[model samples]
Each structure stands twice: as C-alpha cells, then as structure tokens.
Target: MTQQSAAATPMSKEMQDCVQACMACHSICEETMSSCLRMGGQAPAQIMGALMDCADITRMCADMMMRRSPLAAEMCAMCARACDLCAEACAAMPDDAQMTRCAEACHRCAESCRAMASAMM
Candidate 1:
C-alpha cells in the first residue's frame, strides 16, 4: 500500500487523524450554526444546515467503517456527496472565514470517506 492509503487504513495514522478531523468539523458546524445565525442572520441557514448534516453523516460514516460494517461503504459514499455539497455551500460565501474552515474540513473528510468506501468495496 502507498503511504497515503496505508496510513488511512482502519487503525492507521490517517484514519485516526481523519476521525479527529471529522469530529472537529462536526463540532464546529454544530457550534457555528447558532453563531452563523448571529453573524449572518437568516442568510446562512441552508449552508449551515448542510454543513451540520454533512459533518454528522461524515462522522457516522467513519464510525461505520471503523467497525467494518456491511453498510460502511454505502454510508461513506453518501457522506462523500453530502460533504461535497456542504463544501460547495460554504464556498459560496468566501467572506466568512469560519465557513471556509468548515469547507476545508468537509473536503478533507470527503476525501478520506471516499477512500474508506473504496477500500471496503
């Protein structure tokens, strides 16, 4: 396995980091939802919601993969799309640095989820 792939394998360094990243993103999105509301008024609702959902699903996907569940791959695939959408939503607003951070986190989670899904299949 290439260093990259091997690192992300279940218990490897990549997986651990990916899990932490996913968790952080999830927490940030959740925490930022209310803050985004205060910051952006009603403008950030859709994107913030998407980000929250994406973070949640991404975390779940990672957990499932860690357990070697039969549905892990499918969950990860779905999460990849969700994270991609979240990134796009966040990208729509470049002015918000927090959204940018959320976007980057979602992108990283999506990449790792995609790899995990592929490996499962």
Candidate 2:
C-alpha cells in the first residue's frame, strides 16, 4: 500500500487505546525503575530487568501502532507478554506504592494490547 493511503486510513478505537496504554505503561515502568534504584539493594535484579524490558517494548509498541507498521500486531502480542511479566514482577513488591502503580499500568496495557492483537488477527 502507498504511504499516502496508509496515512489516510484511520486507526480503530482499539488500536488507539492500545497505543495510549503502551505509552502509559512505558512511563510507569521508567518511573518504577527510578524508584527501585532509590531503594538500593531492596529491588531484585529480576524486577529491574523486567521493568527495563517492559519500558523498551511498550515504547516501541506504541511507536509501531502510531506509524501503522505492518508488524504492529506482532509487536502488540509481544508487548502484552512483556506487560504481563512486568506486572507480575511489580506485584511481587506489593508494599511499594510505585511498584503497585506500575503493576496497575502494566495490567491495563496488557489487556489493551491483547485486545488489539486479537482484533488485528
């Protein structure tokens, strides 16, 4: 398809919501990572890794959706998985407010991305 045509095509509501969720999740992951760093040795390596992965994937997924990339659906699927993992990691630290907030964002993003991926299929 031509770039013009692709640009002219409007995104479905689901895709838009997924993009927003991904962006939100990305922001929260970054914030959570900062919070974890301030905690020093309290945060585990695994949780940090999960937060990093989620932050990167969520940003990329949102970009893909915004650009209407042909691989957006695949990215959404991957994003959902990443979000789920991140959420689980964050949930492990339930006592931390930042972690809890990040977990909630990840959960919402995961749900939105899952819906978008399935709808695209």
Candidate 3:
C-alpha cells in the first residue's frame, strides 16, 4: 500500500520478463499495424483490428507494471488474451514476413504474460 512497502518489494524475474515482453510486443504491434496498412491487400479489417488491440493492450500492461499497479496481474491476463488473438490473426497470413514476425512477437508476449499472471495469482 505505502510507497515504502511497494519499493521494498523486489520485482520477480517472471514479472520483469513479462514487462519486457509486453513492451516489445507493443512496439512490434504498432510497427506491424503500419506495415500491414502499407501492404494494402493483406490488411483486412480483422487483422487490422487485432493489431490495434494487441498494441493497445501491450502498452497498458507495460504501463501497469511500470507503475506497480495492483491491477497489473489482471492487465497481464487481458494482454495475454489480446496477444493470442493478434497472433492468430497474424498467423493466418503465413506467407507475409511482417505478419509472421508480428505473430512470433505476439506468441512470445502471450506466453510471458500468462506466466506473469499466474505468478500474480
């Protein structure tokens, strides 16, 4: 509750990993969204929506961790789900390099966030 207590509590490795993953996912999703749009035909409404959602959630999850919010765990959980959805959407276009990279990042972030959420529980 107090800043002292919060500061005294060291961050766990899993939490740190999740934070890093979320940040990375955020950047990837954002860049991928633009890249997808530029690619034209491949950027369907569903895929675009997934990229945007993934970017938003990853940013939220990272911010929650940085601020040491009590809701960080819940945010991580939500982020994991979003990342999974994004991964699925990206993976649908196996031939596209950008989509493949985004899918991989999403998968990594999803796994890390899932671990972080479980640890919080």
Best by TM-score: 2
- Cα-based lDDT for every prediction: 0.74, 0.92, 0.89
Query: Tens-digit lDDT track for model 1 on 71-116?
Result: 7678878887888888889888888787788788778878877776
- Candidate 3 clash total? 0
Candidate 1 residue 3 C-alpha distance from true site, Å: 27
lDDT of 1 at 114: 78
Candidate 2 — which residues are off by over 4 angstroms? none
lDDT of 2 by residue, 47-69 (tens): 99999999999999999988888
Clashing pairs in 1: none
lDDT of 3 by residue, 48-82 (tens): 99999999999999888877788888998999999
Ranking by TM-score: 2, 3, 1
In model 1, where do residues sit more than 4 Å from their true spots? Answer: 1-10
Clashing pairs in 2: none
How far is 98's C-alpha from truth in model 3 (Å)? 0.8
What TM-scores do the predictions have? 0.78, 0.95, 0.92
Segments of candidate 3 deviating more than 4 angstroms: 1-4
User: Cα deviation of 16 in candidate 1 (Å)?
Assistant: 3.0
Question: Which has the greatest lDDT?
Answer: 2
